[model samples]
Target: MGVVERTWSWLATGAHWSGPDGVWHRLGEHLFLTAVCLAISCAIALPVAVLLGHLGKGGALAVNISNAGRAVPTFAVLVLLLLSPLGTHGSWPTVIALVLFAIPPLLTNAYVGMREVDRDVVEAARGMGMTGRQLIARVELPLAFPLIVTGVRTAAVQVVATTTLAALPGGGGLGRIITAGFRLTDTAQVVAGAVLVAALALLVEGVLMLAERLFDPVRRRTGPVPG
Candidate 1:
């Protein structure tokens, strides 16, 4: 049978969807790792991006440094991390590597979004005696909301795809299914695993896109209200 047919058959197998090493368990592990890493990346990147973007000070330098991190390969970082003391901590190296990979887009998009808010509107808000905190909360952030959500969506999908790397370190994730298939020379299993990862990434992208539209403050304000 062709790889495609075998992959469909493999995915259809109920036995592969249950148990410790099954698809569901691996999917859960993949999601947990993505969530944790995305959360950590946001925590580390957002406040700094917001503050710098708000002040309009030191933002360029900070953004440049963060963007520079993108050139570093995540797998190399993971390997180096595994060779260090962190190697003993299950999943930390993987988590750390994913977090690092996720940060640049969040920081860059947020900073650019904030900086792109209408300067005239900001001046008008300031003219009305709006304080720094007030301007950020009431003006800049709401205006930048869509772009920030875009950054989040981008990061989430990237993390989902990348979390498969976790299996390389003997950590749990969908990648393990692929690696297992490789070890056993089962092309069908490998194809199924790849399909699962792609489906998950697309699922995340779709959900976040819906969220972006629903929660966009500008759109809500400008859009028609229900009668």
Candidate 2:
């Protein structure tokens, strides 16, 4: 049979969708890992980027340093961590590696978004007796919402796709499916695993894009005026 037919047959098998080592379980693992890594990355990156951007100080240096992480391979980072004390902690190396991989875009985009908020609008808010905290909460965050969401969308999708690496260290996730297929020399299973990951990444992107449009403060504010 052709590879496509074999792949379709593999996906159609109900047996492959049940049990601990099944597609559902692995997909859940994948999503859970992605969520953990993305949340940790956001917690680490967003505050620092926003604060630096608000102060208009130290943003360039911070962004450059974060971006430098992109130069290093996440797989290599995972390997190094696995060789360290952290290796004993279940999934810590994978989580840390994924978090680092996800941070550069979040930090860079958030900093850029904050800096790009209109200076005149900021000055007007300042002139109107708005405090720094009020300005950030009301003006800056609203305006930067789209770009911030963009960063989140980027990071989430990247994390979803990269979570497959979890299987490398005997971790769970859809990567296990691919690795198992490789071990068994089952090309069909590998293709099905890849397709699942790709589908998940696209789903995440679409959901976030929808959320961005729905909750964008600037779009709501600038919406058509009542007749």
Candidate 3:
């Protein structure tokens, strides 16, 4: 049989979709890891980036540090993390590696977005008696919202793709499917697992793109203003 037909047959097998080791279960684990890592990374990166951007200080240094982090391979980090004390705790190493993988983009985009906000608009807001907090809340964040969301979208897609690596440490995820297939020499199953991950990443990107457009202030303003 052709590779495509074999993969389709594997996917059509009901047993593969129904057990503890099923696609549904693996997908759940993958999603959970993605959500947790993304949330933690965002929580850590965004505030620092925004604060630096607002202060107009240390942003270059911060971005440089994060960029240096990106130069290190995530798998290497995961392996080192797995060798540490945290490895005794289930999933913590995987989570930490993925969070580290996710932080640079979040930090870079948020900092750039905030720094890129129109200075004239900021000065105008300041002239209107806006305090630092008010300016950030009402002006900087809203203006920077699109790029910030873009960073999130980028990070989410990346995390979804990378979470497969979690299976290396016996952390259950779709990567398990691929790794299992490799062990058994089942090419069809490996392909199916890859297809599933790719599909999920595309789905996430599309949803976030729609959300970006919906929340875009410039787009909203350009649309017919409320009568």
Candidate 4:
């Protein structure tokens, strides 16, 4: 009860958004944290997915690993990470956890996209003396771009949501608002924090949608997804 009262008092006065370091101060951190995790995921997942999809190897194993990653609830991941070398003591745990969470979509999409590319087109590309790298960069990836972008889009949304979990371990993000509200049992505070998180997720989705359009010529011809 005291916690709730205190939380509301702070919120009513806008203290939640204006505390030392404050909501505005940490907004950048939240975006930065999400972006960093996503960038790292792409760096590893793209190459691995492309190669795995092209070779048609270890796919079951890879998907299984990614699915298992999803089962390890985000909060549990954060708690376990805190117990390890990459915990409240450091930021790497959140990075590692988010990367794990981001990989499945990428791996699945890459494999599916490459497999779905017209085999005849691939043969033509090869028949024309296109090298493996050339086929992938020119023929495969472009056609695969929309689906691949879909994976990135999914990853971005997921990362933004999971980032709040990272806050529980003191890694810092908008989750701080959520956890603080929970500790205080303040409904308004909780709502305020939740509202911000939802807004951020929508913003990320919009940006990714734009990215998909800008890169996917096929999409341009077909038109945007029905909202």
Candidate 5:
């Protein structure tokens, strides 16, 4: 009964918005925080993953470390950061915490993807006079791109959902509503916030699918894709 009520309440969230401006403004803030955290996490993770992958050393060790990172509770990490240099009171700090939450997936995907690129392909490129950068840009990254896209897709969804944790720091998101709902015992608002989060997840997943298709080298190799 609680679950059904929650779902119905979520469905009805949109009707409670006071005006177009308020609705768009709040949603826009949510998106801004989500994008910022996502971008920061990917930027930091990709290069490190690629470098480690290219080194072809410590692959298993690196993966285990990331696994540990994923294992540690995100809320614990966030509280620690808030107490330290992160200060925990600002939106950017919340963004930072979310980025930390996002790192394991992005790092694991990029590193593992590049590592999985066929060794023969790397050797062939080397034999053909490809430089280090050329080997990466043309050969390894291309092959690994599919896996990388999968990582980004996973990260996108995870980041969007996790950004709700930003509410702990007074950052805007559906979490803001959820927090308010918790304090007020307003299950309707809680359900509404959860609904917005689910919708946002779906929207994020759709956009990333388009990105994955666009970047897929396998599709490019097969034929000219329609614009």
Candidate 6:
């Protein structure tokens, strides 16, 4: 049988869809890791980026430091974490590694987005008696929203793809499926696991893109005016 047929047969097996080690369960684990890591990374990166952007000071240094982190491989980080005290605490090492992997883009995009906001607009808001908080809330954030969301979309997709690495440390996720298939020399199962991860990543990208367009203030403002 061809590899495609074999993979299809493997997928069609009902047993694969049921039980604790099933695709459904693995997908849930994968998504849970992705969600937690994404949320934590956002919480850590966005505020710092936005604050630096708002102040228009120290942003370049911060962005450079974050971008430097991108050079380090996440698997290497996970390995180091696994050798540390946190490794014994279930999924904490995996979560921390993934969060580190996710932060650079979030920081870079948000900081760049905020810095990119028009100076004139900021000045006008201030001229209109807007305080620092009001200017950021009403002007900067709204204007920077698209890039910020783009950063989120980028990070989320990256996290979804990278979460597979969690299986290395016995952390649950679709990576388990792939790792198990490797151990058993089951090429079909490995391919199926890869296909699933790729599909999930694409789905996340599409959903976030739709959301970006839906909530885009620029799109809303430039939309057709009533007659």
Cα lDDT tens digits, model 5, 66-120, are 6887778776766677778657457656777788777888888888999999999
TM per candidate: 0.95, 0.95, 0.95, 0.86, 0.85, 0.95
Local accuracy of candidate 4 as per-residue lDDT tens digits, 1-227: 66557545655776557754477766777888889999999998889888877766877876687677777788887788879866655778888888888888877777778777899999999999999899989888888888888989998999998887887877778888877778988777776777778889999999999888777967666777688
Q: Write the per-residue lDDT of candidate 2 for residues 1-227, one digit (tens) a residue.
A: 99899999999999999999999999998999999999999999999888888999887676797569768877677788888999999888889889988998898889889999999999999999999999999999998888888999998988887788778767788989999999999999999998988888899999999998888987887884467
Q: Give the poorly placed runs of model 3, Cα more than 4 Å off.
A: 224-227
In model 4, the runs with Cα more than 4 Å from the true position are: 1-15, 19-21, 219-227
| Clash count per candidate | 0, 0, 0, 0, 0, 0
lDDT of 6 by residue, 170-207 (tens): 78899999999999999999999888888899999999
Better of 4 and 5 by TM-score: 4
Preferred candidate (lDDT higher): 3 or 4: 3
The C-alpha local distance difference test score for the whole of candidate 3 amounts to 0.90
Q: Provide the global lDDT of candidate 4 against the true structure.
A: 0.81
RMSD of each: 2.1, 2.1, 2.2, 3.6, 3.6, 2.1
Clashing pairs in 4: none
Please, what are the lDDT tens digits per residue for candidate 1 over residues 1-227?
Answer: 89889999999999999999899999999999999999999999889888989999877676786668777876778789999999999889899988988888898889889999999999999999999999999999999898888998998998887788778767789999999999999999999999999999999999999999899998898895667
